[model samples]
Target: MKTWKIIVLAAIVVVIDQITKFIVVSTMQIQQQIVVIPNFFSLFFIRNTGAAFSLFEGAQWFFYLTTVIALCLFVYFIKEIGDLNIWTGIGLGMAVGGMFGNFIDRLLFGSVVDFFKFVFGGYNFAIFNVADIGLTVGIGLVVIGLIVSEMKKKKTVAE
Candidate 1:
């Protein structure tokens, strides 16, 4: 849970996320789909100019501003996150990494590159990328950390 270690973890995530995006952009054409599993999963290239799940379709400026605000919040939270557990640290790192990963795309390309796709029960799931994975999982970890912290506080008060 050291700050440096947390930063390193975030850096790694950003690197991996960017590399995967680079590969996808370089190798795949827009709207291309390569089935990894029939009717289940696939690599489908897409560009999203909106938020997660491609909502709010053309809000470029909105995303740029939000990324800046989120990064600012992350820095403030990190300063307050003393003595947190590894999971919390991982969450912080991943969240920041994911933010940066998507922010990079938004800055350079005006959109995010999405590649992974899933289909379930005749529903075509939204296409996403590594950054989205990191963001979702990271947010989940943060929530878990918060729950654990609350439980500990309640236990102490009860005891």
Candidate 2:
């Protein structure tokens, strides 16, 4: 992947994530959630009280620590990404974008605006935002890439 392509992808993710959050924050009142889908899905807007699944709720300082660590990881990954691997480029781009998106939210509002909710049976997951989706999707891509690479390695070694 070209360096310019990586830059463009990062910018796109940042714009989309910020715009979506802007809409959510500006339109919806805090703690006042509206369910877009019933049962298995919904949009319940809330300033996340904790990390994913409401972990570490009372520790506001953890947000800063986590964001800094995430930013460092993104920088390291971006610098180390292989030039020809578009998948790696895209994956790192999404991760960086998501990291920054939530970072900005944390800086400005001290919390992220989470609206998407998924549930099944008696188990209920915490509400998440678009940034989390980007991050998760990027992680999925990376895992898939690693699996495919390993398979190819095994095949080559066996040949």
Candidate 3:
């Protein structure tokens, strides 16, 4: 994919993530839940001061350092994106955009805003935000791309 296209896609992710977070922050109090579907899903405002799944809570510096490292890796890998497939490009764009979205929140507020919630069978999945969604989906795509590539490589080698 073209660099411009990647930029546009990533920008869209960031814009959407930020906009949703802004709405949550502006309209909802902390821990405020707005049920969209009874007993299933809701929007709840909260802040995460740790990594994904709320790991290492209150360790802001750790997250800051890791985010910087992740950003650096993204920058380093961006040059190689020219040879990647469309799905890989999409994954990379989403990952970078989501990373930056949360990075900005961490830098500015020392926490990441989360609002989406899913509860099933008495188990509450982690409450997350748009950035988290993009990041998770993006990483999944990247992993799938890697797996597919490996399978193709093995098939070629067998042939």
Q: Write the per-residue lDDT of candidate 2 for residues 72-91, one digit (tens) a residue.
A: 87667656754526566677
Put down candidate 1 lDDT per residue, 71-149, tens digits, no spaces: 8987788788676776777888898888889989988998999999999979998888888888889889988888888
Give me the runs in candidate 3 sitting further than 4 Å from their true place: 154-159
Ranking by TM-score: 1, 3, 2
Model 2 alpha-carbon drift over 4 Å, by segment? 150-159
Cα RMSD (angstroms) for every candidate in the order listed? 1.1, 2.4, 1.7
Worst 10 residues of 2 by lDDT: 77-86
TM-scores for all candidates? 0.95, 0.83, 0.91
Which residue pairs in model 3 clash with each other? Answer: none
Worst 10 residues of 3 by lDDT: 80-89
Judge candidate 1 against the unseen true structure and give its global Cα lDDT, from 0 to 1: 0.87
- Total backbone clashes of candidate 2, pairs 3 or more residues apart or in separate chains: 0
Model 1 misplaced regions, further than 4 Å: none
